[model samples]
Target: MENKKAIKLIDKILENLDATGINTDALIDDIKELRTYALEQQVPLVVKVLRLTYEHIEANQSFLIPILEDENDEELAEAQEVESTPVESLKYLIALTRNLNNKMNISDLREYKELLMAY
Candidate 1:
């Protein structure tokens, strides 16, 4: 599949449950929170990559995002803004993912950088 790297990243995330001894549901919930925070922080590149990985997870038959009846439109719009070209977006994603890997002390997210490099 063209999304192989994305799949790999998701697998590693699932694997982290066992590795880190975190509960599965709790981890997913935490990731959802991080996703929301990343959006609010206006890190479009990281948000884009995270969304893609979430899509891969959804495709595997798991629900992630909750259906919110009232989401703040202004906040969402701010998060969607892409102030850079695709190339620049990828660069930012690479740097941010590297930062995430270092902070998490897990090399799993490195796949995201590798996948971006292929583009």
Candidate 2:
């Protein structure tokens, strides 16, 4: 059950990537790091997922995260969050992918490791 859900998350990311053509590099690094942490700390499966995801988000801070104060208009800021650069988006995706590889029941990790080279 947990494996299914974890795979679903990866699928979700891949789908989003296909639609948006986003890159995924920095996110992969975060994911891999979080997996190590999860195993060492004995975190629960669900918590591990969330933690890894959060770390992925955190790893691409400049990209995934926006500078709210830079918004020119308050209404626009309030109504819609700005999207990051395409490169930034890809980095975020990579981070998430690596996290998935570490925490999920994945068999071929080397391929994932190789794919996480660019953002």
Find the candidate with the highest TM-score and give its number: 1
Q: What is the TM-score of each candidate against the true structure?
A: 0.35, 0.27
Give the residue spans of candidate 1 off by over 4 A: 1-16, 19-27, 61-119
Candidate 2, residue 109: lDDT: 30
Q: In candidate 1, what are the lDDT values of residues 1-119, reduced to their tens digit?
A: 11344334444544554365333364445455555655665655556556664443445333332221113585654554543333233223323443443543123334453453333
What is the C-alpha lDDT profile of model 2 across 1-119, one tens digit per residue?
Answer: 22444445455555555565433453454345545554554545533443444454456542343222224677765544455554433434434433443643332232323333332
> CA lDDT, every prediction?
0.43, 0.43
Residue 81 shift from truth in candidate 2, angstroms: 36
